[model samples]
Target chain A: MKLLRIYRALLTAQLQATAQYRAQAFLYVLFSVIRPIVFLAAWVAVANARGGSVGSFDVADFAGYFIALTLVSHLCMSWFAWEFEQDVAQGNLSPRLLRPLHPIHYAAAANISYKIVTSIGLLPILLLVAVSFHARFQTTLEHLLLFIPSMILAAVLSFLFDWVQASTAFWITRSSQVSFVLGRVSFIFGGQIAPLALLPGVLGTIAYALPFGYMLAVPADILRGGVDPARGLLLVGAQALWVLLFYAALQRVWRAGVREYSAVGA
Target chain B: MNAPVFVRDLAKSYRVHEREEGLGAAMRALVKRRYRDVRAVDGITFEIGEGEVVGFLGPNGAGKTTTLKMLAGLLYPTSGEATVLGHTPWLRESRFLTQITLLMGNRSQLVWDIPAADSFRVLQQIYEIGESDYRVRLDELSDLLDLGPLLHKPVRQLSLGERMKVEFAASLVHAPRVIFLDEPTIGLDVTAQTRIRRFVADYNRRTGATILLTSHYMDDVVALCRRVLVIHHGKLLYDGGLADLATRMAPYKLVVVTLADGASPRFDEFGEVVASEEGRTTVRVPRESAAERTAAIIRAFEQQVVDLSVEDPPIEEVIDRVFSGERPLSQVRS
Candidate 1:
């Protein structure tokens, strides 16, 4: 109970801090919205070039898919790798290590707070895109119930994966480069380039096999009614499994990272 | 019961990469680098009983901060055994951590963009301090430090002195039993430094907490710490009372003489002339000969000797001699 209160306090402080930089926060939301809109535009054009349908998706389907993708990705994204590297290199981790609280809570609180605070701006943009593009989304009571759990699981899975990657800083001085590589891989496999259905058959299968699709594509697909109840359950199971695996990985990485940190000095 | 803090042969070393200047050497180093072990805290042993305030004195790179980090559980000793409150510091168990705090003057743990008061609240939650207890402690700290209206300002907006006060307060929200302070007054003005020093003394007295403070200012040591540990080149040169360290390192007495008006007398024959001004001369002489030197000066100019006084050299000078290798380390006395 006490730890939860501490986490909430940290989260609230992070939200307040983020509010101080209004202009940067605006830019953050704008740029994040712009990327998926561009991808949505390309797919819409493709469906138009094909006279209303391309690879089982119409222009409306593309619109719904892309909008949902934008929302899910924004909610689940983790920028911890860069932040972690800066914290380690600048010796900012020293004060944190001295505190009794586990430092991961600080990072988790900040990440969650940023997402929640930015979602206010994001929701309006998502609505604007939905209206302007005439996107048609289909949903049911079952999908709504599953969507909440899927979104939460996706967030945990993404954060843990990024945290594990960020822990490479303990062993390598240039962990930022490693983070960049991992981020690029996530971008490609997490359905940023295109919906998994439209991706090459083999690549789509590979995306489903890995944890990337579970982070973005699965939640978005569920929200758009592209998944049936049976598949939705399977997706939720997969997300839970990935969450466990990545959580284990994070524990291992953090232990090694702390040992390296102490050995190397602050 | 064991001491609150104890160490046995605590040491730490780092493997540093070596490379020569030039593109060729850098390129070669990338292929194969040579590494050397730099011992930051060579084998040193010490102990501190509960409620003791010990000052750690050293020049830069003398491993004062490194030893503090080890004791605070922020660093693992390369080879040694250390315990704080009967718990191994490096393990960092919650039971041990809840009873200790570490404050670095140069760094801060507060959220930078928010008000420091908000950060204090966050600390209250983190340490699980009860509402009434938190309020009482905060009120006491605020009154002690004269933190009026500074807590509401954003941390980045606060001056260095104010921010340091907030940092100090935030670290103590839990009323830690053992506190590690690393240069708690590094860059403060004279008044601010004095405020922090007085606060430290008062807090120690009130709580009976064990404090290990490291500072470059000698006054900080003289005012708060009876015992001090002096380190040089990663070695413990002395560990004893501050006054004893001074007496052992500086076995000389400073004599200031004010000659009679219009009568200048030669004082170099008696001792080393540290300074000479209009009719007033300050001389430094061996402790054993200070009396003889003063008597000889009075006899030489019975009418010219207006005033004379003998005193120990300043602590700064004694520390300077120790750092400059003027006084051999083996001469240290406990």
Candidate 2:
């Protein structure tokens, strides 16, 4: 209970910090919203140009998928790689380690808070994109109910995956290059750039099994009415499995990483 | 009775990769790395009692901070055992953590770009302090540290000293029973250093909080700690009262004599003359022989003496002597 309270406090403090730099925060949200909107437009052009449908997705279906994709991607994005680099360079990680709460909680809380504040602008932008594309969305009570759990699980899985990547800071002095490569891979394989079904057969199969797809693609697929109810349940199960697996990996990396931290310089 | 902050033969050594000059060496290091053991904290044992403010004194890289890190549970000792407050430090149980706080000078735990009051509120949540208790302690710290005006300003806008005062306040909101202060007054001006010193003294007096402080400044040790544990090359050298350290390491007093006329006095018979200037002479005499030397110097200057005084050597000189291994306390006393 105390740990939970501390997480709340850390989250609140991060939100206030983000608020203090309103111009930067505003620009960040704008950039985040613009990137997805552009992708939505490109996919719309492709679907329309290709005779109004690609595979099972029409232009409306593309719109729905991209809109949900934007939301999930925004909520799940983890900046821990950059954050860890700065903290290590500046010796700020020392104080965090001194705290009773696991340092991951601090990272997780800040990420969650930033996502919540950024999502305010994001939701409306997503709605605007959906309206422009005349997307067909499922607003059934059941789907809406499932969306909550799915999004939550997606966020956790994303955070854990990024955390394991960030923990590479222990062995490698510069993990930014690694992070960049992982990010590019995630963009292609996690269905951020396009729906998994749109990819070639072998790549699509690989994407479905990898942890990357469970982070954003699975959640987005559930929301876009791309999957039937049975498959939706299966996707949820896949997300849960990845969450557990990634969480375990996260713990292992954290334990080893702290031992490897040199706590160098001043 | 409280359990000792025990450590039985604790050690921490790092296998640092050795890199030589030249591109070839760098490339070779990437594949078949050469490693050297940097024993930061060698096997040592000591225990600190509850509520004892012990100063951990050492020059840079003397393993003071390394040991403190181990005790704070930030690092795992390579070998041996260390239990703080009856709990293994590296395990970092929340109960043990709630009773301790670590403050590194010029390093902030408070949120940047926000008012310090907001950071305090965040700490309130982090430590799970009741609202009433938080407010009470906030008001008390504000009054004590003169934090009223600084509370509402963004942390970046505050001066270094102002920021440190707020940092100290933030660390104390939980009223921790044990505090580890690593150069807590570092990078601060004299006025700010004095203010923090006073604050630390008052806090310890009021709450009886155990403090382990590290600083390069000897003045800080003199002003705040009656007992200090000195470490050199990762080895414990001396652990006792500050005055005892000075007395043990330095057994000589300096005597300066000024002649009434513009003439240098010959005091070689009295002691070893260290310096001589116009109408003045300085000499070092054994502490045991100081009184006798002073009388002899007085007799010699009876017709021409203007002024004379005797004092112990500066603490820094004594510390230098100790570091140089010139005067181990045992040898000095013998």
Candidate 3:
């Protein structure tokens, strides 16, 4: 209960603080939409030129996939890898270590709060695009019911993975490289560049095996009604397992990092 | 009860990599890095009782801040045991952390973009300060530190002094029982330094918080700390009353003699003439012979002497002598 209250206060403070940089926040959200829209436009053009069907996707299907992809990508995101690297390098982590609360609470609160605020700017733009494209979204009661938990699990999984990456700052100076590589790898394998269905032969198999798929592609697939019941349940199970694995990894990394911090005198 | 802050042979060492400033050396370091053990805090032990404010004095790289960090639970001691409020510091239990705060002048914990009061609110939740107590405590600290107008302004918008005042208030929002201040007044003007020193003294008096402070400014220690721990090269050289240390290390008194107007009497015969300005001569006399020297000067120039007074030299000179190795640790021990 105490931790909960602290997170709430942290979140409230973050939102108010972030609200001050209105132009920066709006521009960031505005730019985030550009990539997904560009992908949507290209795929739509392909479908139209090829008589409204590219593989298993029609023009409406392309619109729904990219639009859902945009929302899911924004919802499941973490920046603390590079943020923690700076904090470690600049010795800003000292004051935080002295506080009663674990520093993760601050980072987590800031992440959740920033996403909440940015989404306000992002969702409206997404809705406008959805309306303009006349996107036909497959909405089933089962998918709707499963989508909420899957998205939430995806977020938790993403946060944990990012923290694991960030914790490397304690051991290595160039820890940001880890997050950079993670971002590129996830874009390729996590269903960001193209849906797992569109990936060539063995690549699709590789995506299903990695945690990145659970982070992005799984939620998008479930929401778009692309996966069958058995596969969807399997994907959800994979996400839970990844979350647990990362949680364990996070604990181990944090312990080792703190030990290193003590030896080096942060 | 145990001392509010206690340590026994507490020590900290860092293994730092040494690299030459060249591309070739950097490449060689990548394959096999050479490490050297730098002993930051080398077996220094002392206890600070409740409400006691002790100045931690040292020059650059003298391990003052390193010791403070260990006591604050921010850094683990490589060897020996340390406890703040009876709990092992490095364990960092929430209960333990709630009772301590480490404030660094160069680093601030306050959220930079928000008003300081909002940051205070966040601390309140972290420390689980009750709403009623939080209100009362915030009001009290704000009043004490003169943070009324500064509390609402964004931290980035406030002046250095204003931000420091807010820093003080924010650290005390939880009413920590033990406070570790690392150069809390660094980079502030003289007036701001004085205000902060006074605020520290007042806060200690009111709440009886055991404060361990490190500052480059001697005025801060002289004004607020009656007791001090002086360290040199990572070793505790002296730990006692400030005046006692000064008297032991600098065994001399400065005698200021004022002659009659236009009376240009030679003072070198009496003692070491430290300064001669406007018919007044300042003499440095051995502590044992201060009174005798004064009487001899009075007798020799009874008619010429207008006024005379003897006092111990300033604390800064004594500390400098200690750091410069003029006053060896053996002298203090003796």
State the DockQ of every prediction: 0.65, 0.61, 0.66
lDDT string for model 3 (B1-334, tens) is 3899988898989888999999999999989999999998899888999899999999999999889888888777889898899899888888898999988898877998988878888988888889999999999888888888898888999999999999888888999999998899999998899889989999999999999999999999988899999888788888899889768889899999888885768888878999888888899999999999999989988997888899888888888887888876788752
- Tens-place lDDT per residue, model 2, B243-295, is 78767778888998888777885788888898899988889999999999899
Name the lDDT value of residue B98 in candidate 2: 82
Checking candidate 3 for backbone clashes, the offending pairs are none
Candidate 1 lDDT at A237 equals 96
Q: Which regions of candidate 1 deviate over 4 angstroms?
A: A262-266
Which residue pairs does candidate 2 place in steric collision? none
Order of candidates by TM-score, top first? Answer: 1, 3, 2
Q: Which docking class does model 1 fall in? A: medium
Better of 2 and 3 by TM-score: 3
Identify the runs in model 2 with alpha carbons over 4 angstroms from their true place.
Answer: A1-4, B1-4, B261-263, B275-280, B324-334
Residue A187, model 3: Cα distance from true site in angstroms? 1.5
lDDT of 3 by residue, A166-238 (tens): 9999988889999998899998899877878889989999999999989888898888787775778788988
The TM-score obtained by model 3 is 0.96
lDDT of 3 at A8: 80
lDDT of each: 0.88, 0.82, 0.87
